[model samples]
Target: MSVLAHLGVEITSSTDDSMDNRKRPAASPNSGSFVFWSSSFRRQPARVLIVEALPPWWSDTCTVLCDALDNFLSLACNLDGPSRIPLLSLYAVSRQQECVLPFVQVRGNLARLHSCVEELRSIPGEGCIKGAARGGELLRQAVLDSLQQFKQYIRHISTGNQTNNNLSVEITVVTSQPGPGIVRQLEMGLKDADLVSLKRLLVVQINSVGDWGQDTPSPETTYTEAEESLMLGTEVELLRMENSVFALETMLKAWLQEQGGDREHLHLLLPSPTDSPNPVCVKCDMQERLISPALIPLTPNLGVKTESVRDFLPVTKASANQNQPPQRLKVIKLLRADGLCESVLYGLPLVIRPTTCWQLDWEEMETNNNLFHALCHTLRGRDLFLLLQVEPAGGSGVYSHYVLQSSTSLSLLLKPVVSRELLLPCSMPVSPQDPVPDAMQTVQCCLTQLDEEFVFNPLSLTNNLYQHLKSRGLISQPRYPYRLQPAAVLRDQSQPPEGAKTTGSRQPRQVKPHSFLQQCEGHEVT
Candidate 1:
């Protein structure tokens, strides 16, 4: 049975089965998707119940949802590992039908702590839905394990040699594809306020050229960096990060190669400073000076307290989407997971915002005209970053059981909502393998990004229930992207005009005005 059916929904098995998962109509174009209950009322700390009667497929969505939490989706092993983590994790839970997402409740060890909001928000104005759902089973499993393992890796703070009772972990996810801020928060969670022991590990699997091209896997060892380094590193990467997967992958490979390319994804693990490694590097004054500026130090006599430790918070992780082929899926998923909101590790719904960026395949565009033409022509020639939201239509024939759930009205959790900055942009980097840049620098060399759209759940007013719920709205009325993208500083050249400079910096520096023809004061002065 499905989670929805358990909650009083009625969907047929054959109709909602895997065989019918496909045939569903294309989702909206100018839409972005985020997860929230489609039911009414945004009551505080409500428990999300997946009942026994819930349909079998309902959990599928949750399964997918959990995998995407915190952008820690399934990623390939080192481009050359022993077969990419097999791409998945599947488990049968006892009462997952009642799997709970308590928004307003965090008691016991977490009573005094402030409520943290974990949102899977959108990037500026766009989203990456439908296709992402197509990641299917293999990718799903990998994503699950990675997330669980990550949860286990998030602990940075020592509970002061206290008992396990004193240890508890809590995290919140924000969206907008955060670069460094999210890392900072995790480091903060695991370190001292002064960020003396920023033990949060940061591993990056940069996007790579086609076929991953013999790149080494990141190390499997755990890592931790101090606040100063974490913050600086965050700023540098976030500001200088390219939307390009290849670039990211390459940089990571280079760093990992130094530590021996034996681990996966060329992982860069920063261990707690207090722990002893080889003392040779620390004794080198020049080396110390070089690294000291980039890294902060941990307190003396430090030890890894197992109890208070949080799960592994990946500085970055990747997962391949099944529907779009492994390669494309890998790139887009990371793009979706770049923000603070997209950083969940375990079964937590860190940031449930809409998908802001999308990676689309050309042929797929033909199925949906609104999105097709929208991509063909900007909104009034306005190339703003737009988000497309989509809900997959499931069931038999054209209309399937999945369709009903996707089309169903929005829940209170989705309404009465407040969100900002969940903007959109193509994740393709302007340049591949470029060095870091300043805070405001952008690699605008490449302007074309995938033009895609998704579903838009239409909001409806209850017969007479709307008045009382005026402040909040129902997340209903599903619509697809007629067009996606809002105007932005980044130019979209996918549909550039004839003779237009197809590829180059959009904002060329103003060259000083020079004389059209400097008179040569040579021997024959003209």
Candidate 2:
């Protein structure tokens, strides 16, 4: 027998013997074995240490530094797993050069760390009392000292008899002006460390001030160093802090992409707009309230929810007639799976008169319109189809459907009836002697198939269709209605005409327009 079956037989025999033995009173010696096995499978929580370089001369240094620390703490509070009690440490780079290194200042406990961050917030306002001649260089050394302290802490935790060695470690440096000296010192410190396994070394640069001169490193230099760090298998990123919510969200998304943990279970907490005693809880409440409406059922059948689709109607002026109300058309909005609205319609006024049945002013539509370009950006790399419904001003239920496809550019797809019969016939070869009425007859046939209530003018539709065909290069421009270009003709030149003279060698025959239609019948219009 195979090893698996033999093992299964042994397990069955053991279970049978245990069941028999349970009838007789015995000591429960192995009952706790299952608990021990499960304990071994549980994962140890990760510990993250954040070291920030806060200079006294920087503008709004305290506010920026406090905000970043608060943001990191908020993220820690939202982490998943019962054992995931995240340890966060924050240190402010000092300007004074001291002989003794600063201790592992912040502890792992959340309450204690919160108090430490609150204490550091006041340093920016008071300013550094004893400033060193080379402050940047001193700050760099302080950061290295902090890293060494963190490594010692990791070693101490792992060496304990009762401690779990599965814990991961990460170090993040937050700074506004990171000079080359700081970068070199950090690289050397990380390279020399062999005892601790560093998960990630992140450098976050907050650009609160607009000045890019002497104090701040240039973009090219920062990019080159970041690239080198990545090649060495270190996770490094430089983030510019922006006030806009959209910009901040984009930055966080890029950071999340590099994370090695489970993204679905991970939660990122940002600072609340308003100052609150408990900012993390306030932020969570605001998010739930904002997204609650989208979760509600808006349809009667509970088939389609508000989160999946939305609808809008154009604002119209009051009607003059007291007997009836002005007509309003429904515009349906559909969202992609990623919760992004791909298209939105702007309700423009429609003009109706005896001369012009029911038409929208193209000039007015183009004046203050940017929705098309915005849609292109939102729906990039995806195909978008818009179904426009144009209804008459009266109480009539009839409406026309116009399909528009939008991509890098927009195009109008002629209705199936118009394309197959009218537009296709116009491009087909015609005899030079025949009048253009033959093609016009095909358009008339298509018109008969359309609804009688369709308000668009036949002449206008024909002209627009012809222009669209010309732009797509389906047919040459009409010099004359019946004139045919040589390129448009197709004929089989294998045999000569019955009355034509035959020479010793065969010669190419001139193509006639009448015979071209037979060859082009199989061509399909895009």
Candidate 3:
């Protein structure tokens, strides 16, 4: 049974004749087959972790790195919004390499992750006496191990599931040793077929203080050198970072940046008229929008904590209306007047731009963009809104958007049609309101004049809950710059005050005073 059913909520999607179906149907010029785009764009490549297990000599660094990894895993598992939780595979490398965890959805797998962390921590140095001497050899072997394990995992999944045959993988390698030997091994091991599935290879070198010499190249140069050596026509990012919590956060931020976590999309394809046979498919990316803040619940029990299945479910690309194939937006109805209210408006609003992905030639793209601007101008001039049936990528849902044009770009305000009536007539006759008083009208005019145009970006804001957790020693600093302060800034504080009282503080019990009012002055009623 699904998690939703376990929670005593039964979700049912129905196909009903709504306003869009009942309205005058528009004629389509194209009678031929509709070419559906591949759903792969909606999904992201799986992330695989290959972290080197440090020996006893690097105990301090090992402790800090393990803690950081744990925090990162927890955060990934409990990410906010309706997006799918990332799938991750964990591998640990020392003198020998071992797969601590296989490909598993990060959501609702905290217990498994904890067990994996334990295994990572317990990994002992192979031949303790020779461990320090064989560090370089271990690093080289680890590189080969990571590549081999990744290939094996990919092959296993491809054989098991045909749909996942084309799935790509993003490999993140965390090692203390970064040298020419490791680079050469990776270059030799990776084949052309392997490169196709490998989206990115992020090498995070955990270095000690004073590891870099005067002749050592910068991180960018290292990345360039690695890419050049691989010669697989693929980019490789190398980050040489110190063994600290701050460095881990930076590594995660860089990794997330590559994963496009910062760049979220609301609707993929723009609304095009059905009359056009070859309608231009304009891909849109969301801007200046904030989702609701979510805090993962901390439970003492071993079982993984879950708030809602919607938060953890894998985000798919199938159309919400399963009967219909993916298309460039469907127009439901055209609004002639401003009759809709806040009651009809549902879900987070999105401001979209056609600057991200496109499936048109340069000449055609320019023409389509010009047409978009014209449409926006027309909508603004006529004070009209287009009610469109938008099936967002990731199978989010079939949402009705009350779309209007801003001076900049198209603004999609999610306003699903309400099935039930909202407004009810009063028993008394309706009375027209008189003209506003002069003083009130003057105040309103002044207020309007004082108003300044301000754009609010949700991505720009930080999560207060996350900050609180960090302050209380419950969580670590977030990976993103917008989410928290930089590592240097965080380190500059030296020591934070202890036992600070914020929200969720325990309050002393209030003592009730003697009820003199109930006693009625001198006369006490029994």
Best model number under TM-score:
3
Provide backbone clash counts, one per model.
130, 0, 0
Q: Order of all candidates by TM-score, from best down to worst?
A: 3, 2, 1
TM-score of 1: 0.16
Give a tens-digit lDDT track for model 2, residues 1-526.
0001100000011221211223433323342111111111123223343434345444345565555555544443332212222234445655543322222322223465566667666555434433222444554455455556656665675675545433555555555554343454455444444424556556655555534346444332244555455432453444455533333333332321112233233233433323333323211110000111111112221111111112122223445443233333234443332441212111111221112223447665554245545654454456444444445323333233333333344322211001100010011246778647954554455445446654445455544766787787645545443444454343533355788877877654555556555456665333
TM-scores vs. true structure, each candidate: 0.16, 0.35, 0.40
Per-residue CA lDDT of model 1 for 189-287, tens digit only, reads 333222221112332221212122232212311235543453332221222333243433332222111121122322233332323342211111100
Better of 1 and 2 by lDDT: 2
- Higher TM-score: candidate 1 or 3? 3
In Å, residue 276's CA in model 2 sits off its true spot by 61
Residue 162 in candidate 2 has what lDDT?
A: 43
Q: Which window of 10 residues has the lowest lDDT sum in candidate 1? A: 285-294
Q: Note the Cα lDDT for every prediction shown.
A: 0.23, 0.37, 0.48
Q: What TM-score would you give candidate 3 relative to the actual structure?
A: 0.40
lDDT tens digits, residue span 1-526, model 3: 0001111111111221222212323222231111111122223566778776655434545666777777666655553222232457787766566677877766566789988887777776433434322544454455455556667765775564333422567778776655443444354445343466677777777775423234343332344555555554555567677778756854553332213443443443322333334323434542111111112222211111123323222334446555333234567766753554433333324444444345578988787777776777776666666776544434433232333323434533223332211111112345698656964554444445343547655577676987787787644544432434458866754443576544556553343334433443565444
Q: After superposing candidate 2 on the true structure, give the runs of residues whose Cα lies further than 4 Å from its correct spot.
A: 1-53, 78-85, 96-110, 125-139, 159-167, 178-181, 188-196, 210-237, 243-526
Error of 1 at 379 (Å): 53
